[model samples]
Target: MKDTIKEKVASAVRSVYGIDASDAIEKASFEPPRKKEFGDVATNAAFILAKVLRRPPLEIARQIAEQLSGEKEFTRIEVAGKGFVNFFLSPRFYEELLKKIVETDFYVSDIGKKKKVLIEYVSANPTGPLHVGHGRGAVVGDVLSRVMALTGYKVDKEFYINDAGRQIKLLGLSIYYRIQELAGRNLTLPDDAYMGEYIVEIAKELMLKYPEIVDMEEEKAIELAAEFGKKVLLEEIKKTLERLKVEFDNWFSEKSLYNDGKVEKVLEFLKEKGLIYEKDGALWLKTSQFGDDKDRVVKRSTGEYTYFASDIAYHYDKILRGYDKGIDIWGADHHGYIPRVKAAIEALGESGDWLEVILIQLVKLFKHGEEVKMSKRAGNFVTLDWLMDEVGVDAVRFFFLTKRHDTPLDFDIDLALSEKSENPVYYVQYAHARISSILDKAKEEGIEPSTEHLNLLREEEFELILKCYGLKSTLESVAKKREPHLLPYYLIELASAFHKYYNKNRVVDTDSPELSSARLYLVSGVRKTIRSGLNILNVNAPGRM
Candidate 1:
């Protein structure tokens, strides 16, 4: 409906001033007015057309308002301050929209048009459990994927494992030496060894799994320890993510990029393009030529590939996969890494714009207005597991999405657990539950909702309908900006509007059955819209809160 209005305005612009409509197509917007009395939807078409038409802005607005006034879609067309043209939708518009929204196809759009996109996020090293920081990235990536899929994109969720790195080697050694100390052997843990007790737990498991591991040679024991630690930890990570309702279609291993000489193959490709150069004792890529701060090393003098080298190869592999686009969600500390990654992709003969990176900032946890001090498990940070148990899966996901991905977030634990409107997740769920309970009572009273008397709906009912009406546009904005936080913020405002309208108007009235049935249909429409919105965030909208 919004799209049709915008296209009509674009057509009017072309008809009024002989300019091509394409110039104003993207600019023709029909957003809601700030003041309700101003009108329902406001368009700045005259402002956009003033230069092209060579007239005062108000005159141009009046001309376009005259053209649009004859249409039945709007009941009132007013020329607002300066050149703003405000449109109040007609009763028939709301009547038709209310019926369309009851069906399943109202909010879905073909904007994405089936373009394949790969979203990779929460690829934390498998050496430890996922922390609250990882939780933020997980929700952002997962929500963005859902929004994209809603707009007709074929999306793939991926997690790239950094299993072939110095960190994994360090993990193996930590478990190995810890096991030696447990067996009463004389050995000291290296200064740089992992300090988490989880490493000791893995070492014990390895000892029990292989009774002769302690008797084995040092190299074999470390290899066994590495495999055992990564496998166990990876399993726990999967379970934690599942508990949070995150699913990954692909678990890609960094080691796979190194297999079958893939890293060497990328080096050769860069060399052929003359993008690789040697400096001192290392092979470097001319990343500065591609807008990085400086060139980055791909291979050291010891003939070992750097982490950046593995990433370049992995992204090059992504190019071969034939995705229309790719996105990466990384930690706040990785903001500086974006340039080099894009540079690597460009050097591989693809436009750097094909890849998008969203950096998720740090999350600071608070409980009862005090900062959360420690985790229940052995770690310096709060784990995702403890968070899910402390509040819940719904609260954790919703709170993590409360802030923009690039901004620092302060998560209030107490408010999340609250049952009042102070908690956004609860507030939205309560509205849905309230509607469900009303519908249930109506069922008991033998009153079923019918669209038979929709014209009986007044300003407040239409106000709520308009609020529920912006779902399509809000989702499009989210998908384009790659921001999932918009959905949570939007759902809150929508719930508040529904609550205000519900307070003064009785949805189930025994005095007037016809009016009661109409309001019930309106209430049911709001319930379905809220449920669809919450589903995008993987936050359940319960029938009973």
Candidate 2:
């Protein structure tokens, strides 16, 4: 629809000025009317062309409106608000579009052009199950992947395992000491050792499997402990994500970067480019030259690779895997880490544009007006599993996405479980359910959905139709902005308009069967659109919620 309007406007511009103004034509875009009196679609083409035409924008707008007045696509075209051209679509236009909804199986565009995207998210340390913090990043990455895929990108969901380095060694030591304590050896845990009860659980499980681990050398025992802990926690992470209905296309192991010599390979490349420097026995990347506040250690003095080094290798591996773009969903705390990673990408001779990171703020859980404290099992924050069992997977994904990624979200445990209209997710699902009920009832009454009398649809009915039509644009915006929160908000507004419409009008009125069929046609479209939007967010939109 936008393309049709833009093409006509481009033709009008040529006819009026006798010159090509493709750039201005491209700049011309439409906005929904600020007032119903302003008409269906409003554009500012004349405002863009005013200087080029050497005329007042308002005069140019009037001339353009005059030229377009004969267009059958628009029933009314008028100039208003400093050269804004308001266009009211012909009744035929709305009738055809609303009919297209239920008459078609699905409607989506190939806007992404099949660009391959690697979306790496929730790469939490395998120290414990994912908490609410990791859950936020998971949803962001997961939904972004869905959005990109819908926009026609070839997307691969991934979780990068931080299974190598000091953290892993500490994980092993934490479990080993816990095992020692359980075996009657009161070994003191190191200050940096993990302190979660899950660590003890892992230790107990390991004891049963490796009863002779105590007899092994200390260094060898810790290695075995670390490997065991990493495997267990990683499996748990996978299960938790699976339960949350968030699955990754790949689980790229950070240990592989070291094992496959990716870390050393990138390190050597940087060294030869003079991008890496040795400082006090540590190999440092001159990240300061690439917008970091200071140089960063890729490898510490003790010969252990830094987490940043592993991240570089992981991304380099992504590039080597033939992805056109790479996106990493990270905690907001890692905002400062973006530049160093970008620097590494550039140092590896890839454009920084190839890698983009979305930093998401943590989620805070609240219950009954007070902070829901403690993870009972994990010993600290709320785990994603706990939240899922408490509320539901649908509510968890929906509510987690109700706010922008950069904003801290306070998940209301009480609100999510509430079936009342105030629950946003439930409210939207109810809209779908209501439509399904109407369609089902219509089927029983022998009044099938059809576009038989679409002309009977009034202006208020177009409110829902237009909003449903906005879905494609909404999704395109989401993919372009790299924000998935826009989807829920759009859904909420669409659902609200639909529910309000249902309150005032009947979708399956037996008294007016033709009108009923048309309205049912619109309702069916609305239901499918809502379901599709929910599906993209990985939220459920049950036909009977």
lDDT of each: 0.88, 0.86
Q: On residues 1-545, what C-alpha lDDT tens digit does candidate 2 reach at each position? A: 56557777878878887888767766777887778788878898888888778889898888888888898889989888789888888878777777665565334667688999889899899988889888888888888888888888899998888888788888888888998898999888898778878988998999999999876788899999999998999899999998988888888888888999999998898899999989899999987877677888999999888888888788888899999999888888888778888987887888888998888997888999999767878886678999999998999999989999999999999999999889999999999998988889999999997776788888887777778877888888899899899999999999999988989987777889999988888888899889889988888778786
Query: What does candidate 1's lDDT look like per residue over 467-519, in tens digits?
Result: 78778878988998999999989899999998888898888888888999999
Which regions of candidate 1 deviate over 4 angstroms? Answer: 10-23, 35-38, 46-68, 78-84
What's model 2's TM-score? 0.93
Give each model a TM-score: 0.93, 0.93
Residue pairs clashing, model 2: none
Poorest 10 consecutive residues by lDDT, candidate 2: 100-109
In candidate 2, stretches whose alpha carbon ends up further than 4 angstroms from where it belongs are 10-24, 46-68, 79-83, 105-107
Name the lDDT of candidate 1.
Answer: 0.88
Error of 2 at 540 (Å): 1.9
Error of 2 at 545 (Å): 3.2
